[model samples]
Target: MKAFILDHYKKKGPLRFGDMSEPEVGDDDVLVQVHAAGLNLLDSKIRDGEFKPILPYRPPFILGHDMAGTVIRVGSNVRRFKLGDEIYARPRDGRIGTFAQLIAVNEADVALKPSNLSMEEAASIPLVALTAWQVLVEAAALKKGQKILIHAGSGGVGSFAIQLAKHLGATVATTTSTANIELVKSLGADVIIDYKKQDFETLLTGYDVVLNSLDGDTLQKSLNILKPGGKLISISGPPDPDFAREQGLNWFLRQLLRLLSLKIRRKARRHRVTYAFLFMRANGDQLSKIATLIEDGIIRPVMDKIFPFAAVNEALAYIETGRSRGKVVVKMR
Candidate 1:
């Protein structure tokens, strides 16, 4: 198997492309012949070691998490799928190398790919779409007619959030630069704010939910536009105490997380709103539901660029520009 890897953490380190042995499957795992892998900011963060404490990866680790491929081998416990099933997953890290031509993942985290999607498009949805689904639908429970704001409206998660919120009958608002206003609108964002030219806080208010993917400053401001009993869900900084507890951080780290979240949470309480930091988990069942949505034409993948397997490092570099309108994909096979 050929893969891109880095042994040391460097912000600008290059991915070394070379040959490596393919992974072995466990009893509950399935081996996949990789077709396409999605690139995300999470990959860059992992490469830089920003998430080392909670989601540590061993040196010589394979960094890819999102993929779409065909099942080539099924372990004894993998009764849900069969050989040659087209599937997708955001595999738990350090288990499978989606950047390689083959991968093995727990059957619990593998879902059948939407039959209507191309391999490249299927690769783009798992991670970001699940993040949107878990945050808006499961965690926040955003209801019909409720107002919500999705920041970076043309990006990976934003594209999914816009459509999903609309699917649930929520009145969706979103922020993007002028160039992507129409793009966001087409994704069902009822109101589109040009982040560069307009202040969203002033342009809209009384939103029931705000999906904050921007900086800390933007997240704080997002709280201010909410009506009483509103909720703010962040995919950026400002970690939740529950998340820290789930990660089993030590006392000092837990305190640090609480301290960081204190002011914003207090402000949210003052306004009768709830605040939470969203960290999406990989679940094959949730991915299966999202796949059905795609097949039903309720949501669609928004791909910005596709790079050959050898150019994965370039794909990672391109997303760091913080201006990609949609997902960047790596064709692995």
Candidate 2:
């Protein structure tokens, strides 16, 4: 099989495209023929060795997270899907390798692709959509009439999050550049903050939730905009102690994360708000529900570009520029 292999971690490392052994299917796994895969900042961050402490992938591992494909083979214990079933997933951490000709994903982490979407579009939904779902639905339990601020509204997670928040009946505020103001508005953002022209903290107040996908400075600023007892959830994170415990890190690593997030956590407490770092995990059931929303026209995939499989490196470079308005994809077939 042809796949992109990360021989080593480097700040600007490029994946090596070459032949590799076929993936082994487990009892609860499905073997998929890759059609398309989505690109994410997480992919780049992993390549740069940023997640080494928490998600340390040894050298010579396949790279990628999001994928849409057809199930060509099923394992003995798999019953929900069979051969020829079309599916999409953000494979569980440590098992992700979607930038390839094929991958074997655990059945529990796979979902049927939305019938209304193409393979390219479906590929873009899993990671970002799941991130939004986990943050808004699972973690925050955002309610109707709540005011939520979703930062970086033009980016992958932010674009989907704005729509999801609006669908849940929350007043959605988002931050993006002036050029993307209309784009976020189209996604149902009630308030659009042009970060280049205005400071969001000055203009916004008393929010129920603030979803931060930006830098440390922005993360700190977000706390002020939330009302008392509000949730400040960040996906791009200084992972909190809760996240460390959830990942079951060693005591030393847990202490390290505790120390890393102490300042921000204290600030959140002082403001009478709760802070949490969310690292989204794979869930087939959540993806199925998201597919229903997509099929019902309540949410839609926002795409920026689709690159050929051979241009995967170029696609990564393009996303790293921080200019892509929505998800970027690479077509494998």
Q: Return the TM-score for each candidate structure.
A: 0.97, 0.99
Q: List CA RMSD, all candidates.
A: 1.1, 0.5
Output the lDDT of residue 198, model 2: 97
Candidate 1 regions exceeding 4 Å error are 94-96
Q: Write the per-residue lDDT of candidate 2 for residues 242-313, one digit (tens) a residue.
A: 999999999999999999999999999999999999999999999999999999999999999999998889
Backbone clash tally for model 1? 0
Which parts of model 2 are misplaced by more than 4 Å? none
lDDT of 1 by residue, 38-106 (tens): 999998888898887767777786778799999999999889999999999999755746788888999
In model 1, the Cα lDDT at residue 225 comes to 91
Give residue 186's error in model 1 in angstroms: 0.8
Alpha carbon deviation, residue 55, candidate 2 (Å):
0.7
Worst 10-residue lDDT window, candidate 2: 4-13
Error of 1 at 158 (Å): 0.2
